[model samples]
Target: MRYYFVLTIFSCVFAYEKDLTFSVQAGKTDCFYHKVLPNEVIDLEYQVIDATHGELDISFQLADPVGRIIVADYKKSENAHRHTAALNGDYRFCFDNTFSTFSQKTVFFDLMIDTEENQDKEYDEDKEMEFGANSAESYMMRMRDISESVSRVRDNVSTARRLQELHSAHEARDRNRAEEMCAKVMTWSMVQIVLMMTVGATQVFFLKSLFEDRGSSSYKKLIPGLGSQ
Candidate 1:
């Protein structure tokens, strides 16, 4: 029971992963920040999942705590970045869609902060406790092995979850793009059908007018003596 309680606490402390989706309107920028400690590993992945006018691209920028740009990507559909925090502060992420006048972009992003130092410290603290010189030593060793195995499993699960989320985002983007293309194709096909019908009607009316017989008054307008004849 004690081991389970400690494991729960550990999991809670390391649950700083985030998955987010938001919109960046045309001529505007959207920014977010996450607080991180020094030496923590930061993993960021983002994709422009959907957009108006088939424009699935946006500018991304990441800035350090001291306002220095650590990474910048221009007009990208998807990107990922990994960095280690050198100072303790909030890291800024910005998505820029200012180049688009009327198209808005929908973005999906994943952020993960891994504190390996803290995990190592916790492990060291567990090791510092002196075990009795008896059967308790073997029991303690078994418990430690169990804890380590659980931690490994947890890490694997986290990685799998992140990959699944990213795959889902990609699927959504592709589905939206396909739907948009289908709509455009249908609209243009209808437009072409309407144009063809209009041209056919116009040609028929012109031919009929050309073949029409003129009355005596129309002839008189063309030749002065034709009406009398």
Candidate 2:
């Protein structure tokens, strides 16, 4: 009976490791919805399998349930290999694969939370220790701050994408309009030249007829109008 009881106590104080599989997309960013509580840290570990085809940009934000940011930053090669969290409520991880338009890549994330009551196990069990109210309050405040930052980053990412698409669409429309205007100008110029030629031919024919008639005598009455001929 004592052995079984000891095992139960040990189980409650054990660390947990979770494995999550994420497939990187081509030309799009994927957001993973998650939130963490205080006293727990979300550790993200990733592996790039086929980085030759494309690259990956991973970022994370720790937030509160009501949407506030506490800690947020992109994963850099030097700093993000293993990340530790202080306080967290809703923690979101975003993966941007838009830069890798040529091929698809697979990435894995390992999340571990030190949930064991005595993870450090350094506290002397002979004496009881308790966290004061002040410490608890401080932890709560940190959680809220992290939540807010996460929400802001997420919003900014989406807004930036929308702006980029709008700019591209506007430029394409402007280019098409310019091409149409050039075609119209060329067509109108050809029409103008053809009309001018027809008028010139008509005037020449009338002048020649008048000159011949005046030399004979039939156009003697109209001779005054043929002085310039």
Candidate 3:
């Protein structure tokens, strides 16, 4: 009985979840498709993390099996969408960078498919088998209470994982921006330093030239009496 309980918990904990990171080159479109069954729930979240030209925006679209657009966004930095499958077929989603001529976009996305009904049905069937030998009413009630608690914990874990992934992606995007800004500032500072050094050197040379005579003949050209001395 204990072994069966552990197995059930493991099954519930390991649900269907996929996380991916990819790059979409400039003036190109990348697409993916997943097969889903009717009544299954699909959750999608995506963020543009980094870009070559510092433009953190991309076009996104989700289409149903019949070529109907169910969710669409234009030049968005980050967005999420949730939908329930109505038909059994391949659903397509795409990331478009066609609007960018020279920038490549790096994107992070999460996809989750939830079949709560089927999970519940399987749990119920297992519960009946586990309790069939022992018909005590109070015992069955107690087991059901435990099952509910476990289900709640499973849901909380899933939510927490999703939130953690989103936070990580946000941190990465911010870090990239900070690094780019730092590089620009450093480059400008170096250029200013070089210009200041060059100007100072020119001023010093000019001041020295005023006090030193190049030759007696040259000095005599400026002062009429210098050649006689």
Better of 1 and 3 by lDDT: 3
lDDT of 3 by residue, 100-216 (tens): 999999999999988775666777787777678676668657666776787788789989999999999999999999998999999999999999999999788667668786763
lDDT of 2 at 216: 66
lDDT of every predicted structure (CA atoms):
0.83, 0.51, 0.86
RMSD of each: 4.5, 18.9, 5.2
- Give the TM-score of each candidate: 0.82, 0.40, 0.82
Off by over 4 Å in 3: 1-14, 122-139, 214-229
Candidate 2 lDDT score at position 48 = 40
Candidate 2: residue 121 Cα off by (Å): 8.8
Clashing residue pairs in candidate 1 are: none
In Å, residue 172's CA in model 2 sits off its true spot by 42
Give the higher-TM-score candidate: 1 or 2. Answer: 1
The superposed Cα distance between candidate 3 and the true structure at residue 141, in angstroms, equals 3.0
Off by over 4 Å in 2: 1-8, 55-88, 117-229
Considering every candidate listed, which one attains the maximal lDDT? Answer: 3
